[model samples]
Target: MGERMFPLERQKKILELLMIKKVLKLTELTEELNISIDTLRRDLNHLTKQGKIEKIYGGVKLVESKFGESTIADRLISHIEEKERIAKKCSEYIHDGDCIYLDSGSTTFQIAKYIKNKKNLTVITNSVPIVNELMNDDVELIIIGGKVRQNEQSVVAYEYLFNFNELNILKAFIGASGITIEKGISDYNLEEAITRKNMIELSKEVYVAADSTKFDKDVTIGIAPLDKIDYIITDGNIKKDFINKFKKITTSLIISE
Candidate 1:
């Protein structure tokens, strides 16, 4: 058996393990760390209190972060079909010659894919993935320059706030880390949240594109209340209760087929 570690050392190991595995069962953790259940529980409780991890049924998982929950590559593959459906549904809203804002996220990257056939559309975005997707397309592309977040492959900084005022954005399709009736739409990164809020303020119509899994959840930063959104576009897998709840808050709740 390995020598027992100090509480801080054990806790640090637990967090490191969670950073790799994302989630681990209680028994698995104890066995791997060669610690008692009670000791593991104490460590978990401390981590939970510090907001580094969250306890789930029979296991613990790291708290969500921009790319900490899962890297952008992982997120791009996750719920791919659902994201495609949501993106296709969102594309129906875009018209030729329209200027739109696509926020940085997996779903918005999918939107970039679907809008390639549009004519003379101008896309304003901070997402590197979306920019790559539409780089050769016929549409006009505008990139918001800022600090690049490596894992998320997005740019965000306070310097672009004044730049948004000059453009007339007809529609803005934003992404959310979490969505609830109360908090509305929330994101994990403060810089991203600031960019989204500016886009929402300047656009004539604001649409939030998120997957069903994002519903009824709250995250670290709140972007705007639900009333600020004109439309909520999500996959058809969303619960009826969530659909009903969101419909009451936004002007329209669009469920992709």
Candidate 2:
């Protein structure tokens, strides 16, 4: 039998376990925690009431967070200032004649506005908004061919696997729906996650540009682990604890003002 724990402690433990496993059968959870069925039920009810978990017929799974489901337009207006700060700081790493991959996201779209002045730069992207932003600029622009996802204003790069294989990206700037020490970086959409993964693998340097709100969250599909990221750029609003935690993972954590 597992040692008895307070209600809050047990509930916290249950949530932690759910975070890792995503879904857990009632018997499995009870056996793993050595808790009574009634106790587990109470915890499950509390979590369900909080909209944190969904109770299935015989198991429970975490509720999908709304951040990942939001459209690009929705995201664009939500964290305008924070996104701009992070994007401005991210743009500092770019230079003339560099081949960079910008993953499709609202933050990366903000990067397009800042990089219009760079000469001889090659910008490759799957974002329709980013393409529109940089099309008339004096830089070479390449769009990854794919099915356009209207909500995201981005391409699902499944049609251009060959092009991705041959490209040598100098630096890749990516955005995430969530970031966690355990999950590294993740997004809700599997196709987007796969696209980001390919970009990370092909790039010499990988930078994740996200606001402080992205930290300590997890989503359905994982893009890459912390070991794969070279830098994390975020706004100054990030907590000191997150700074300390991420410093140990990536080469640099740039906190933008």
Candidate 3:
């Protein structure tokens, strides 16, 4: 949910601009930064509290400060090798101009880690963290409008499902709290579950990016039935029995090192 929201580089760009311009208007920042107003507001808030910048009503200016960055930096460091491998392998299906949906969860965010630089891709997501990951990329982004959840660092529910039927999503990369032949795919939050369900329904193909630990576990909220999944991309350490079961449900699967 961290850089998977807005990368460290983009945040640095804002600070760099303030260093040069001293005081930059919101319009200038938005225009030059190429990030949405709402997203910039959140970044500015973070920088303000970090004592790196002073937030004015319509703009911000850099401030000399020594506060260390917290909360997000180390997050991208966890499950490092596994997530990176899974992310790279799962990303093979994403073509140059594919329109896709990326779900919330650190694992799915890993998918963004690999494809943020892919040109002409259209990524539709409700995860605030995912937006952070791709904000500076050369791609079209569509953030699903909804209330942002602070802990999860994602947006969900509300009117987000309205025009999904009109979007021709080529593929959906989802994160699962649990994946079993019995309960299907699930997440810990009902709101997130519903949101992921919405994305699965909108896309032509659905792929779950899960680590080995989530294979047999079942969480609180259900996302979709087993058969809805088209591919399962995960670490090769998964149990053979679990892989056998998954084969019966999904059309294809990939186990990456």
Each model's lDDT comes to 0.86, 0.85, 0.77
TM-scores of all models? 0.72, 0.72, 0.70
Candidate 3 on 122-153: residue-level lDDT in tens?
99988776787688888798988778875466
Clashes of 1: 0
Tens-digit lDDT string for candidate 2 (214-244): 9889988888988899999989888889878
Ten-residue stretch with the least lDDT total in model 2: 13-22
Best first by lDDT, ranked: 1, 2, 3
lDDT of 2: 0.85
| Candidate 3: count of backbone clashes, pairs at least 3 residues apart or interchain | 8
Q: Which of candidates 2 and 3 is the stronger one according to lDDT? A: 2
Candidate 3, 141: how far from true, in Å? Answer: 0.7
